[model samples]
Target: MTELTVKKREAVGKKVKAIRRQEMVPGVLYGQKQKNEPVAVDKSAFEKAFLAAGETGVINLKIEGADKTVPVMIYALDRDPLTDKITHVDFYRVDLSQAVVAEVPLVFIGQSEAVKNEGGILVTSLKSLEMKSLPGNMPKRIEVDIAGLKTFDDVIYISDLTVPKGVEILNEPETAVASVKPPRTEKEIEAAKEGPAEEPAVEEAAVPADEEKNGGQQPAAEGTERPSEEKKADA
Candidate 1:
């Protein structure tokens, strides 16, 4: 990819707010073969370049009076969180001959069969990776294949990636980038929703005699008809 060139700017002061009013952003470019120069880039043009190059995209920044082209990377970006507009930007001067370390995004290609044919979930543990590469050798993104992942035990490691020439991966070999795991089954979901089941106590069902005594059943009717047997014994 080629770098986008911006125009030279001479305006500097608090009144530089006027530059924004004119649809331009004020920034400084420094590093590599160039001195720190006050410059302004077209707001629209910069938006286009930023979209095309993204965060890792490189651009050829040219100033009207500069002696030569200085390849740069978007080092810092300032934007309005509410308006989603660019407020300012910082460009780092880089030497094409030297290697720079930056994080590149990971793009997953192909659906895992484990995720498609079986009930499984694809989990990503890493979103991007750090690499050291010269400005001219930078890659847009790193691609990962997930087609071979067909079971819950399958995992893709960082060491398995095939990096391009001039680029070096900066993470540990054992780091997991993505994995396929069994999804929560219907039974598991019901178990989670039901929480824990309580066991019934067997000892609580026996009723105490004292409580029954207080309930008024009437004692034996008190010897109502035993007089005949006593009279016969007396005769």
Candidate 2:
């Protein structure tokens, strides 16, 4: 990656606004051996760098009045929320020989058989990774292979990545990066559309109506003669 240098800035506040009006972004740079310097860069140039190298690329920053190149990273950017126009930027000082930690985006490549052929969803847990590397050795982005995913249980972990040389991933080795999950099938959709399941009806207990109507009626004693027999003898 090459460096980009901006001219030294002289204006502030309203002057900065005027610079933006002229399609320029006001910026500042600070380094270990260098003092805080105000600079202004062509908006188009900075945009191109961001578009091509992303935020993690090692940039060669050429600042006005400095004969040598300063290794730097795009540390901060302020932009209009609605217009998405660059308002201001801050560049951080970086040493080329020393390793620096940066967050790099994760790019998943290839179509998963589980999602495309077997009707599954691709679940991605980690969208980016933290890595430490020297400016010149920084990678554009980490590429993860998902072409072999075959089932909901299929997953890719940080340990499975073949990281490029001179870069070390800062994430835990067991972290899940991507996975193939079973999609909601037609049956599941129909079940959802049907709403809650119906509960089975309970049967009511039956009461003996005859026992209730003949409240205290009693049966004849086992060894005693019936009252009808006694009545017949008397007659």
Candidate 3:
């Protein structure tokens, strides 16, 4: 668990933008059966704690002037899309004794012989799993071993995952965590490279009625007389 200090914040709405300039990141803390309180923490301190805690593990939030430190988990984080700076955060207070559900990231470890030796593509079907555990028992991340993947047909499933004694995985044991797919054939590779076919070009058969087809001259009217044989006879 990481311990971080924060201060109670009275700033609300538009004032938060100003608070950020002072290197104080504004956030709110709320949870089941917990009071919603606005708080602010030094951006540098918060970043250090967040990196350690991620979102699954518990954090010890010691607010200034508060009597007791609170256990919290990162509920949400908003970031600047372009800058990728942490904009605002939502902290979820958690009861140490009560069980809560969170998604723990799956870290794939070890090289698979199927991929290293054979021409196979490694596929990670599940990147995370839902788990229920007390705040004290929660893990920041889960590790899935891929060393057993010796063949393209082999896979690592949820049943193979190991967790802390108190943690409960809420997914089926048969769920595939990682596997090696057989290498793509030349035909398949070519088809993928070709992409979708181009649309057919428009034909010219639907020309407008006012437009001439054979030439610029319009056809002679049906009843119009033909020109007399003006051709001079051979002399």
Candidate 4:
């Protein structure tokens, strides 16, 4: 459903800077065993279409002077670090008959009874699932229903996803998607605020001076390039 118009780019290196200043986004078309083609596309049009398609959905690329349109997906987007403006794009051409691997985002819908009445919290594990499907059959996003979580022990797993017929999920069926956790008790809250009790400090007994053992003069100073025994031997 998304589409963009792009023209074959002759600019490269520092010359591409001029292209961006002209309000065109320079890009490359690659993938599906085809040679990469340098091109420039309309800035505003490409932004809107890329936003809708993301990296998973397909887009119709209408190149300048080329009679045929190609099915492509936005593979990479280069943006200015400070301004966050679109600088460059990379489009991967898709073979319509072949299957493609893509990450499909999970959209959580509905309310859980545990969260509403029992004061339990919902925790999410996996936010997306990797899938393999034909380009035309690929879903933009998958919806995960959380209405079935009735108690703190209830959880939704990958097997519970409502996937379309042609798509194949690549994760384990037993992988948890979301779960309900029991609410914190008052005792635990108080313990958390008080933290662990500090241990009392122990005072160490002072060692007796070596002069007390030597019976007269103070012992040689510590680490003066000569040990006390060696100093006594030298004396």
Candidate 5:
């Protein structure tokens, strides 16, 4: 478990900006049975703890002046669009005895024979898996072994995944997680390189019926001065 210490925050609204300028991040902690508490943490410290615990791993959050540390998980984050800096965060207090659902990132490991020997492309359909487990039993990430993908026809599905005894995957059992795709043929590769077939050259704009009746000259488009207006301007 990762441990992070934060101070109770008094700043709110525009005053919170001052805390951020001091290299602190403002956040709130809340849960089913817990009171919403505003806190501030050192930006660098929060980053390190987040990297270690992610969203699934349990974190021991200590609040200044509090008697006991609270077990929690990062629930959400807000970032500055231009700088991509963390602006605010939400922490969900967790009960060790209760079960919770969380999405665990999937990490692909091992080489596929189809990709290495048969020139097939490895395609993955899932990037994460939703799982239910006690906070203490939650895994930071799930490893997916791709070595079994021996051919283009071979696929790994949710039902095939192995996890800890207390953890239950919530996704449909038949969902395909990974597979090997047949490599593109030479002709197909060339066509892709040439880009989509030149969109059939837009047929020349059809001559308007009114223009056809008035001879070859196209009528002035709407919003533009007509020949008569131009003649009047010249006069």
Candidate 6:
């Protein structure tokens, strides 16, 4: 477990900004049946601890003037939009004997024969698995070997995973964790590279200038006689 030392923080509201200016981050620690305690830790130390422990790994948090250290996990974080610096944090105390739910990242190992020999694509449906285990039993990450995927029809499901004795995966047993997809045909690859075909442009009918001026009424043809001329001829 990683160890981090923090001090009791009296800064609150706008005064918390003063703590940051001094290279300290303001945070709160709380858990089930636990009182919320405000604390401050060195920015550099907090960052190092966070990187090592992530959100699931337990940390031994030592508070200044306190007799004993608290076992806690990083619960949440607030970061600056521009600099991505940690502005605030939350810690949750954990009981050593109690089981905790955490998401463990899935690390794929080994190359699949389908992908290496048959040129098939490896598709991973799950990035992580939610499981319940004691903090000490919780693994940093779960390793998934893809060597068994020798064909496109082969699939690795949640039920196929092997975990520590105390860890219980919460995902459905039928959930597919990884699989090999058949390679795309040459035509399909070409179509994807070219993208969708553009639609044909519709051409507007050409209108005579005279018809436009006369509210879309076409003029008489050269050989066609006007109403007045026809009347004169009949007379």
Indicate the TM-score of model 3. Answer: 0.81
For each candidate, the alpha-carbon lDDT, in order, equals 0.82, 0.84, 0.88, 0.89, 0.93, 0.93
Q: How far is candidate 6 from the true structure (C-alpha RMSD, Å)?
A: 4.6
Give all TM-scores, in the order shown: 0.74, 0.76, 0.81, 0.78, 0.81, 0.80
Over 98-132, each residue of candidate 1 has an lDDT whose tens digit, in order, gives 89988889999999999998968899999999989
RMSD of model 4, in Å? Answer: 7.6
Report the lDDT tens digits of candidate 4 across residue range 1-235: 7878899999999999999999999999999788999999989888789779877899999997778899998878899999999899999999989999988889899999999999998899988899999988888899988999999889899998888999999999999999899889999889999999899999876556875676745566877553567787988
Q: Which of candidates 4 and 5 is the stronger one according to lDDT?
A: 5
lDDT for each residue of candidate 3 in 1-235, tens digit (9 for 90 to 100): 6999999999999989989999988999998776799999999999999998898878999989988988889989999999999989999988888999998999989889998999788999987899999988888899887889999889888998889999999999999889999999999889899998799999867544544653444455679853444633432
Q: lDDT by residue for model 2 over 1-235, one digit each (tens)?
A: 7658699999987778888888889999986677898899999998987776667876788877878887788878898999988889888888888888888889989989898888888899998999999877778788888986877777899999987888999899999889987779789999999999999899876555754564634544679865675798998
Show pairs that collide, candidate 4: none
| Model 4, C-alpha of 166: deviation from truth (Å) | 0.9
lDDT of 3 at 110: 89
List all candidate RMSDs to the true structure: 9.0, 8.7, 7.7, 7.6, 11.1, 4.6
Q: Which stretches of candidate 5 lie over 4 Å from their true place?
A: 198-235
- Please write out the lDDT profile of model 5 over residues 100-211, one tens digit for every residue: 9999999999999999999999899999999999999999999999999998899999999899889999999999999999999999999989998766666788888988
Q: Where is model 1 more than 4 Å wrong at Cα?
A: 9-17, 33-35, 191-235
- Tens-place lDDT per residue, model 6, 1-235, is 7999999999899999999999999999999798999999999999999889988899999999989999998888999999999999999999999999998899999999999999999999999999899987887789999999999999999999999898999999899999999999999999999999999999999899989986687887889964675798998
Best by TM-score: 5
